[model samples]
Target: MKKSGMSLLEIVISISIAVVIFIPAMNMFSTTGQAVFKTRNFSFANSAARRISQRLMAMPYEDIVEVPLPGIALFDAPAESFFAPFLNTSGTNSGAKNITQADMPEFYSYLVQHDFRYSLSVSNVSFGDGDEIKSVGILITWSENNKNMMYRLYVYVPSL
Candidate 1:
């Protein structure tokens, strides 16, 4: 009998080869997707940190809240928030006054959706005279794929 189409064995072999090639391709695509997600999150954290830093720089030296070392934990907690005015607090407010979902709905929403949180801390930097400058630090933390990540922005603000 003359063969008109692929034999069963031939077909099976071809399918097996295709599967072997496609499986790795699919896995590569999945890995690429995860990398993109990670990059996106990093970018967002960077942008937000810069923005918050800018805000801190623009404010009067006295206006910025000053907390001792480890004043605000790097984690999310309303009571110990770094951005006081922007923090959303419950009735009879209590916390560090950091950024929150209530005070900053849009920014907070992005943080909430991305599982990001931020905290701020300020320490006296005695240069020449009394409280001539302060060291400000903003900490942004988030969880990605069950891993914890953080970004810290620190700068010195001279009294203006």
Candidate 2:
């Protein structure tokens, strides 16, 4: 009677072919996962930067200039979130609402559990013939697989 199963050589050859295909397929999946992770971090940075920028724009020019947040070196990754001090705090000024925990969703919480860090810079700049504007810069940095990633946002707020 004819055998219904493959010989040992046939089985080994088939297994080798499967391995060859599986290795590249697994590599592709790993690469895609990294890309998704990187993209997610970038999206969060963009939204956080926008939220911080808007907060600075809403504040009276004096506040931004006088009470700048602690600065972070662009290349150094801090052990904690730099914006933690500015979050969930009530402002001394009446009708002033500094960013609260609810104001920026997942901002503080994510930083608490993640490597993401941020910094803010407020500096005076001459606009045309007048010096009544301040340039606000927000830097967001994080590490991914031992690689550093950063995002920068700039907005100008006029003295009020």
Candidate 3:
């Protein structure tokens, strides 16, 4: 009598070959997923930075100046005021001067909940012809997979 089905040894060899091919394919899929996640996070950070920059540019020239607030570092005052509109209240003096997670708008709180932090700074810089302009910088930082990532954006607001 002749057996028509595959032998036990043949079945074992086929399974081993399938595993060898399957391992690499599964690894590739996992790597692709990680890359996509990182890219999405990066895109969100970049958009946040740009939005902050645009807000800075739209402010009046005088409002963008770094004012020295007592017991606080320079530029802190203007930075806080710059973000004041996005706070829960309409007035700058409605609450604490410092920006905390609680002071963030709904959209910003959403970003914060996702582990993102941001900072805004404006400094005076001299361009060609000795004209002084306000250079606004926005920095966005986030953590991903135990790694820290940052994105920075700069915009110059000329005197009006």
Candidate 4:
């Protein structure tokens, strides 16, 4: 009687084929996943840079130039949402909405918790044409394993 079953050689061949196909497919999936993760991180960094740049541009100009406390960097000041209204031209909640050195950590902490590392640099450039440009540069850096990423945004406020 003829046995109705796959031969041992046939079974082995089938399994081998499956492993060959599955190995490459699984590798492809993992690679795609890593690329997606990196893209997402990059997008987040870009957004954070944009957010801070917009905040600087929306300032009343005067506040942007107001020197920070001695020994403190300008960008490092107004490091909290509490100081938003103060930097802008309008709005009043209650009491003085000031940003202290203590608030700096809160801002950095917020970004770090959100998976972003942020740093900002501001400069005032006056051209010979009598045009003054206030440039605010925001840099956001983050890393995963051996992969490193950064985003820089430059916002210029021309003399109005």
lDDT of 3 at 96: 45
Better-scoring candidate (TM-score), 1 or 4? 1
Best by lDDT: 1
| C-alpha lDDT of all candidate models, in order | 0.70, 0.65, 0.65, 0.60
Q: Give the candidate order by descending lDDT.
A: 1, 2, 3, 4
- Per-prediction backbone clash count: 7, 0, 0, 0
The digit string of per-residue lDDT tens for model 2 on 33-126 reads: 9889778888988987887787787766776743233344322223223343343445543433223345444554555444666676778866
Predict model 1's lDDT versus the native.
Answer: 0.70
RMSD (Å) of each candidate, 1 decimal: 6.2, 6.7, 7.0, 7.3
Give the per-residue lDDT of model 4 (tens digit) for 37-154. 7777778667656766677777666455532212132223444532232344335444433333353456544444434455556688787686778876677766565555667777
lDDT of 4 at 13: 100
> Residue 22 of candidate 3: its Cα lDDT?
100
TM-score of every model versus the real structure: 0.66, 0.66, 0.61, 0.59
| Model 3, span 1-160: residue lDDT tens | 9869999999999999999999999999999999998898889788867766776777667776442211121112244444443445434456544344444455445454556666657788766685678876776777688887777788888874
Global local distance difference test of model 4: 0.60
- Model 4 clashing residue pairs (backbone): none
- TM match of model 2 to true structure: 0.66
Q: Where does candidate 1 stray beyond 4 Å?
A: 2-6, 66-110
Better of 2 and 4 by lDDT: 2
